[model samples]
Target: MALPSAVKVFLLTMNRSLGHVRQVEARPLPPRNELQQSVLVKTFEELFAELRQKAAERPEGSGTVAALDKGVHFIGKKVVEEAAESWMAAEHEGRERTAEEISQLLYQAQCLMIASGLDLEDVYRHL
Candidate 1:
């Protein structure tokens, strides 16, 4: 089965920080299912690689590949839009709804990362 897009998003965003979040008993992703740390680690790594491979394909004409090809400003607009939606969700709803919005925001950020040609490693190096 294909993984959910949100799972793929984490592969880009995950850093060493999550482990600390867990250990500290801080709720990193509230309203998320109680996904085991191991499951999250395994699935996210596999799915993230898959997304990167798809991006490398650079499909022509339409869809996500085409949207990304339109360049930075287009991608930036999407990121901004997603961010606003997420903020509104967090303010108005309970944890579950907020989680969904956050997922959308992360997925948009992943799109921007793909458009920038920056893999997770590039992000790590930058940080």
Candidate 2:
């Protein structure tokens, strides 16, 4: 099945942030029976790479670009907002909702990292 428009946009934004010149196309999910055998997952390393590229390119109309343009303070506020939402979702929402909120939180946090000129290695060292 084709991805929903929202998902497509999200993927497109992600690809653009990664400095991909080509358009992103939605791919069908693996069959349910094969899910346990193989699943596609994007790692945090990939996300950091994308954020680094976004910091450099600053593409117009991209959320990552907007966040980066706003600088670290604004991005830090968003990170806090997403974190609060994630906590609330975990406390009061369903698993999927909680996951979604957490994903948002992570994205914002990554944006903050980019704004601050930090990378995965820096974070890993701190951790």
Local accuracy of candidate 2 as per-residue lDDT tens digits, 11-125: 4333345575555465666666676568555567877888788778877788899878888889889989999898788768977999789888888988888778777888999
lDDT of 1 by residue, 1-127 (tens): 4545554433232236454322222224433355554345324345456656667786565466766778778988988988888877866887788877877666667777877877777777876
**Model 2: per-residue Cα lDDT at residue 107:** 86
- Clashing residue pairs, candidate 1? none
What's the TM-score of every candidate structure? 0.59, 0.67
Q: Predict model 1's lDDT versus the native.
A: 0.65
Quote the lDDT for 110 in model 2: 89
- Supply candidate 1's per-residue lDDT for 39: 42
The C-alpha stretches of model 2 lying farther than 4 A from their native spots are: 1-40
Please provide the root mean square deviation of candidate 2 (C-alpha atoms, Å).
15.3
